[model samples]
Target: MDVADGVLVAGYRIVRRLGSGGMGTVYLAQHPRLPRWDALKVLDDRHDSDSEFHARFLREAELAARLQHPNLVAVHDRGEDHGRLWIAMQYIDGGDLAGLIRRGPQVLTVERAVRILGDAAAGLDEIHRAGLLHRDVKPANILLTTDADGSDRVLVTDFGVAHPIEDGVKQSGGVATTLAYAAPEQFGDGPVDHRADVYALGCTLYQMLTGSVPFPRTGAGSVMYAHLHEPPPRPSAANPQVPKDFDAVIATAMAKNPADRFASCGALAAAARAALTPTPRRRATRLSVAALVIILVAAAALVGVLSRTTPSQARPVRTPVSGSVDGSQWGAFAYIAQAFPDLLPGFPYGSGYEELSGCLPQDTKYNNVPLDTSLPIGTLFCLGNRDPVIDLEIVCNADRTPIQPGVALADFPEGDEAWSRPSGSGHLFWGHTTFTDTGSDLDGHTTGVLEIFFDRADRNFCRIQVVGTPTTGADLRAAWWPGAPL
Candidate 1:
């Protein structure tokens, strides 16, 4: 089999070729046991004839597999089959830096470009720490993937074939068509080092910023001469929006002399980050030393007293969940409607709604209760609607667990924040916690959380959450609740 579609190599089922490079042809393959996919790099059989290269490939494959870093593409498994060397790596769905750059400035903003570079730098530094040099560092070698949580993760690829630091070799001597990213020493007699990769990274950043390579020379002789002699081009000159500091950064990274270049790829990336960051302005006003000392001393005294306390009553464990939860019954809605008819100013803005939800996903907005694992099981939702469509849901469970009073307050951190005692309630005593410190609703706006523990013998365990609009704890508690009237 040609290791084409439907062919199996070392138990990996080949799907299709992802890409090909000088090292080998890459194929998309399915793991033998897992349902997930892997990018399998199979070296050409022609190179397998060289015994020395074969030994090196296996040794380095093992080394690459040993590396475990979030920013580096993980090498999962490697083996030889039918006189071919193959290595399986993590498949990144987000495509390569070259492809992202091809999309131009509309997609690759300066902040995004710097962030991606920082991730690549971290991975590159890790490889260097492992005594390896990624000689061919370019946009094509950088891979991108997004996590399930909607965060972008950039991983470095092709480290399996990277040269060990001991292999001090002259890389780009005479003339080459692909010397666009080659360092100066590559075309000279001096031994090439990690600085070569730094130079290439600088070149990559240049292309990412300007939408074109630093030197677009076509002729082999011209390219060689440019790499050996020409000074690094300024990205700001091409794209005025690029910070001027980046020009100095590129110059240092692509410095003609190896010693003149940055000590490490991380340093270059850090410089780039600094270039992007605006200098912080010094605060003119200063707090008096005596006033600051008094505040600290008072806080220390309060912390000592509060630290000695505990919650009078231990809260009940969460309710057990079964199948999908029923939302049709206006569980908490009926109570809120009677208690505070004005809370949900009906139809004009947001739909009047409520849900008796089981353990909903943490991301769900309709279920406003802050679902801490330690809390009671039942959930009651109340929709007191507002603008850009904001809704409030208060989930309450009927759990009557008795405990002693005067146990002491559980926590008292610095600030005016304190758990106020629920006394003299008319209908429902409101307790509030804001989601600004917690997390946003599904719609990504800050949400506020509330848990109302009714002081009655039954002691209904209630949690209310405001979703959609950014809200303050003090403001929400004072205004949003439906207190006594019902």
Candidate 2:
């Protein structure tokens, strides 16, 4: 039965319908005696009539109500109104994780992504400690909002299908979890446990990092096949800005075997945190100070990577090199100038106008340029671009470290066509990337990106990526790489 606005169910006055899912419709309602509002969820007639559904709904209300954590949504009351069961929960004004992702992948930096995951993981672990498995874990069920103190508050909601951990009891039935994040055991007659939640958390983490489900497929069959047989897709492969260390983390979290997965969701979050922390920079004292090195080199058409907010306000934070080797001739910047004489040597200008440490600020509308990917690596080797809406930047190692080109290329995998050829002391790679770039003052709404990689593995290198680039594999030797030929 539909409850109109101003109608009272169990004494709580309904305001308006907030949203609806398969089981019920959630509404904003006035609390019976409190000076506040609550989210009122009423069961559908079909499910409310089922005795099994009645037990499960009661289980949801009871189990969730018993637990109290900052990250889990609180249940206040539940009762039957006109033969339909209903529940009142703390109303959250902010949106869910699915909404955050829809805003675009650019909004989810590594820091922001991990913070959200950490909150969700904490809530899941608490549930597990209370002897329950949140069988339904997905982006839509995760809520995101700001606390009254202006801090991020994430709430894990909708434990409608939570099942108790029954050891060694293998069961076969219809899948009760999201298909995209389902573990292999979930698709078979295997013993399912907390590790399944761990696997789903892995998928959720992937979505936060790359803004797409780990197994992005239109058909249920394809997603199921991927979960059951295929390997987990790397987050760094989807967004180059993501650190490569996360690849191994995602792999272990989404392992085909539940035993292979992390012991708990908290463990997975810890691994991800470790991945985000950069390894200590080499202690070699033979590198030049970047701040001292940067100056008006000359008016040149330079091309590279981009992350920008607004050109007028943002300035990149440059680190000054110290010690005797600050004047050293051996460096990534010097190597790029010698290798590509026509190509400009510089770094990236950060996005949405946020100041990035070590990133050289460049304007989006002007000839300003930012360097390579968000990876904390060597100096970027810029090519050519005059009035650029996008750019291509390749990194050159400061210590001349030998990064295996194939392994490095695997980090940026979802491309239309990826190929390589010999460049000065390295191999130059090119491909059509799958990174979807969006901005308000965009050139042409960013239909595609052309990625060019100058890999001097013995010297560690980077990809030259340009958003809003031409769709052409016709000429690799052409000046379509902004202005320079490969």
Candidate 3:
């Protein structure tokens, strides 16, 4: 029974068909007596003739309707039309999480990703407590919206494949799970429980952080084999911005053995929050600070083992410095500078650009450069065409202190500093350096400087100042430092 737009069903008028899939067709619907609209989903007609499928569909609707968590999508009404099952649910104006992720990994920061997944995990916990599991917990099943105060609202939708937890795992005749995010036990006729949801949530969080599924969808057979046998790579490996602790969290939640995973979805979410949380920096004696820097410098690219501690009692953990260049005194900035010419956007300026890379060794003998052991090593690169020359300086530190925007204007001729708050990429500390009589590659041109602090977890940072930059702050960030927010 195809319901057309403007058709009335059980006192609800169908505005338009929202979407359709193997499970059912969803439509924008309105209640005649109510003021607000609702999402009306009608189960496929083919299942109406099959009593078993019909019963299962009705059961799912009943179960979902009974669930009333803030994070879970609300079910407004359920009824039958021409022997077909249909449900009216709260209509969400904001698109699904899959769309947000498809935009880019930068759309969801580490903090935002954890909060979204944590909310879904809380909703999943509620479902699990009621003796049920969300069999499908992929990005497509997660809906997103913004609150009146501009805070993100995450809603878990689509309980079409929800299953009851019986004994340790629900008895299932066949697997009905998304292969890319399924647990090992979900592949075979093994007992599946809430742990399956934990595994799927882990996979979802991985995608949210790195914009790629745990296992590449090369082929169905390959994915299945990989899930069962291969250990998944850490998200931090793909996106260095991810904290090292997150690697352990993903590994634990997506363990091949269910028993090795977190105790529950709620526990999994809590672990994720802890893993991504940054350690608080405290004031220490100069000797202690020097020792800490020495330990971090010596550790070099090794993973930092983080322990969970409350904010009031938080302590510093030695974060491993991650970068391609190792121990040559020149930091990762020198390496990235070599690749900056190719990484820059190409249109009118790509064919005729000159690239020059150099670095000033940190000299305690020179008063211009600080002698403080806490200060990071720096590198400089110059790239341009005939005009609007771009000069970039990369700074790296083992410590995770926040970047200061004013620091970018230190070397240039003294000028009135105009600092702007961080924008699209939180790592950017951009501003303008006007009122200067500097004589360099840029002799007589207004200068706009941007300090881009790379991934804190990796301990990489850079200061990019474009002389005669003919673009907005947003454009400069998008073109030069794509991974600043990733």
Candidate 1 lDDT, 401-482, residue by residue in tens: 4322221111211112223334323122222233333332323233333333333443333334443222433334433342
TM-score of each: 0.55, 0.58, 0.58
Over 1-486, each residue of candidate 2 has an lDDT whose tens digit, in order, gives: 356889988999999877553256688999889999999998866575599778778778888898899999999999888887888898999988765654444455688889889999999999999988887787778888987897679999988778778644354566766566778888778778889899999988887776566764423455678898888898887666688899999999999988888999999999999899955444224546663234213212122212334332263322111111111222324444344422331112111100001123222232224333222344442221111213344454445555444422322333343444454334334333343333222323322344454445533444444433233322222224323434
Candidate 3 structure, TM-score to reference: 0.58
Q: Looking at model 3, which ten-residue stretch has the lowest summed lDDT?
A: 345-354
Per model, how many backbone clashes are there?
6, 16, 0
Q: Which stretches of candidate 1 lie above 4 Å from their native place?
A: 171-178, 280-486
How close to the true structure is residue 323 of candidate 2, measured as C-alpha lDDT? Answer: 11
lDDT for each candidate structure: 0.59, 0.62, 0.62
lDDT preference between candidates 1 and 2, better one: 2
